[model samples]
Target: MLGGIIEFLLLKQSLPIGLSLLISATVVSLIAVLIHRLFIAKTKNATELSLIIMTIGISITIRGIVGILVDKNAHPVKPFLSFSSVSLFNLVFSSQYVIVIFSTLVLAFLLYFYLKKTLSGKIMQAVSMNSLAARLFGIDVGLVQMSSFAISGFIGALAGAVIAPISFVQYDMGIMFGLKGFAACVVGGFGNNNGALIGGLIIGVAESLSAGYISSSYKDLIAFLIMILVLFVKPSGLFASKDVERI
Candidate 1:
């Protein structure tokens, strides 16, 4: 919405996408902070009722607004090139698959370096590793948490944008994307970015295979089954942090 509004008003692309991404990140993180401050942090109880109620309200509000905006319409995007397959070792790969795999690897390395080499990244890890110690070192824990959430939001938005170019994105599309992304996070092990990436890829590949071999309608069920199997065999995650000690 911001990007579209900017391009219409400014008649330029120079600042539209970047500025939209920034604002989206800010807004997303601000909402997250509001929920934390209003419900989670303020509550004496640990049952999460406040948080749940707030989120339920948010969900209905979003859906109601989106439902009003959408019509019974469908459109599709046409790729610029002809369909062709590339042979990679034993498996045959399509252009889209190749792009997805390459981008995933690049994103993985970029995130790894971002977390390891950057000062903010160090602070983020420190805050998650030991928040009390991090605070004692003069780091603003609240600010760090907000920044971390902002980064997560930015990534999520970018991923949505990428998918939108290929797949039709409606206002309500976030539901399925968020679910899959959350599943990936769980598969990756919460608080571990590397794990998230691995988990996402694993889920993607599993879904692809299952859809190819089994009924397409059962892909979701198969993905959940895979998740259950992984948890049973590797409780933390198949690609959980190496430093994590098993109980």
Candidate 2:
């Protein structure tokens, strides 16, 4: 969705970079919300299964659409920020990498604070723990779910924008990202945000080291291998409790 929009706006319409990205993000979010309301919200049982299937279907549909509308070839996005590289402790980092890291940290902090401090966040947490109890306590479960989906869409769009400049955008870019994200969640603990952050960092470092030492071609393989090891060792995830909750 975003790749197609960016390609169309930049190549055919000749829009400015910022505007194109903004429009793409907004459109994608709206479409996601619509899909959630139509397909996701209506599930009565096996909601997680429905969601997983729908998500995969949506991803494939978006990829197919983008391949049809835009060329399957990777498209380059103009650099939004440019600065000289900085070196510290014999390691060099680009300004863009710094920006991405800083942005991710800030977003994570903000999200943690929101989930810890805000009433809406509390309601969301409550719903996650027990939707029936949350509703019994007068919380709007539907609203919470919709808000989560909207936030997810926004964050996903932001991620796409951030990565597009560093790596060329392509129709199938979401596949690897989605897999890594899922692996991170699984390794971190399914319901723990901080664990997800830690897991992502671990995965990132592991992949980089694997590529640097072993083989660049096996970087992705290393990530999955880590995930499999984690699963085998701690199926509940690193941060999850051994005891299962009884609903």
Candidate 3:
């Protein structure tokens, strides 16, 4: 919803495609939770997996219905930005992809700082890591859990909006990417936003490189392989620490 509007705004302003997508993605992602938390509150689902399943199911169902109703062969909207590249050091990447990278980085740092510095952030980290102790401290566990899901959902939707243009976002579009990203969240360490960010980036770059140098069909598989390897080696995820503060 927000992505669509931002795309329209970019078209109106004549902003570059890459810049428009990046800006819109961040803005809309920041707002996507208005709906994500709405659903979570109405339904009583807990845990990231449950929220993920719920959101994924909704995305697929809506898209599937649209695909059937709209006629799947309809032409997609064209990119509002250019694919031309400019030098940014030594590596050459899509101007759009570069924006994605930078946007992710900014979001990651903001989240990390929020978690490490603010009172609410500490409450969330403590609650997520140890609900019993958090409750013992008189924190509302349900509220904290909702906040966590809300943040995750907002990020997911933001990813959906940003990546939608890079690929044609049909009704069924969110599944593969969402699955890969969720795997990334797990491999990076659940409850750790920094982990999710790094995991997503690693997955994204690996995916891009694999598709560029290897096979496009194998791009998505890399996330699963990474997840399996990480599970076997670390079990708790690459960034998980003893500081999870389990109750």
Candidate 4:
């Protein structure tokens, strides 16, 4: 929500879309780091549930603040390219959709390379797997945690910026995307990037099909329903690996 609004404001100022997205992503990344450092990291004896609640509180606070400051109105974002739509194989797609798909693939590959080939990324994996053990090995767990927050924020802001052109920018727009993302994660299985990517694809296709065949009003519902069904049949997700270390 905030990211989309920031990008919208930057575009309003006649900034190049690339520059606006970069600025928005950087600002949000900084904000996420501050959130972890000031609130999350400062918490004592925090359980998963407590952290989840605190994050939810923080999200609500940010949403309310943005609504108050930016007004509760939807703003249109222009497509990044000149063309509005494109046709391929007799099918039509929004140009922005192609951009979104290409961007997602490129980012995923970069993230995969970072996590698999970089020492810092290995340290992050170690920290996530066993923070206490990583600390014993002299790794800075806190720094890794902060870095994770920054990466998440940066990716989220970029997603919001790109998606705004298709979904419209509004204070409350993140909620649905957030929910759907969580559903995708559930469907994909936690801790598996490949699973996540496949899960997101599944959810996206399901929503599109539902909107076309059933009703647009129930498209979001279809994603969650698939998630629930996946949980029932395969709680670990469709592509979940039995070996935790490999994931």
How does each model score on TM-score?
A: 0.69, 0.88, 0.71, 0.95
- lDDT, each prediction: 0.63, 0.77, 0.67, 0.91
**lDDT tens digits by residue: candidate 1, 1-247:** 2111212222233345445445544555565566556654565754647757866776666556645654323333232125646777888966555655565678678888989999988999999888889999999987887666556655555455434435554556667667777778768876677888878888988898989998789888766777777667776776666344557
Cα miss at 46, model 4 (Å)?
0.6
Give the per-residue lDDT of model 4 (tens digit) for 97-176.
99999989998888888888999988988887778999999998999999999999999999999999999999999999
Best by TM-score: 4
Q: Which stretches of candidate 1 lie over 4 Å from their true place?
A: 1-60, 69-103, 242-247
lDDT of 4: 0.91
Supply the TM-score for candidate 3: 0.71
Candidate 4: residue 102 Cα off by (Å): 0.7
Q: For model 4, what is the alpha-carbon lDDT of residue 173?
A: 99
User: Residues 1-247, candidate 2, lDDT per residue (tens digit)?
Assistant: 3643464456447777567767776777787788789877876774777778987887788789878977688777655565547777999987667767886888788888888999998888889888999999998888898888777776677677767767778888878887999899878887778888889999999999999999999999977998999888887788873333333
True-structure lDDT of candidate 1: 0.63
For model 3, give the 10-residue run with minimal summed lDDT: 71-80
Quote the positional error of residue 63 for candidate 4 in Å.
0.3
Clash pairs, model 4 backbone: none
Q: Candidate 3: list runs displaced more than 4 Å.
A: 1-59, 65-83, 212-214, 242-247
How far residue 98's Cα lies from its native spot in candidate 2, in Å, is: 1.1
In model 1, residue pairs whose N, Cα or C atoms come closer than 3 Å (at least 3 residues apart or on different chains), thus clashing, are 188-195
Best by lDDT: 4
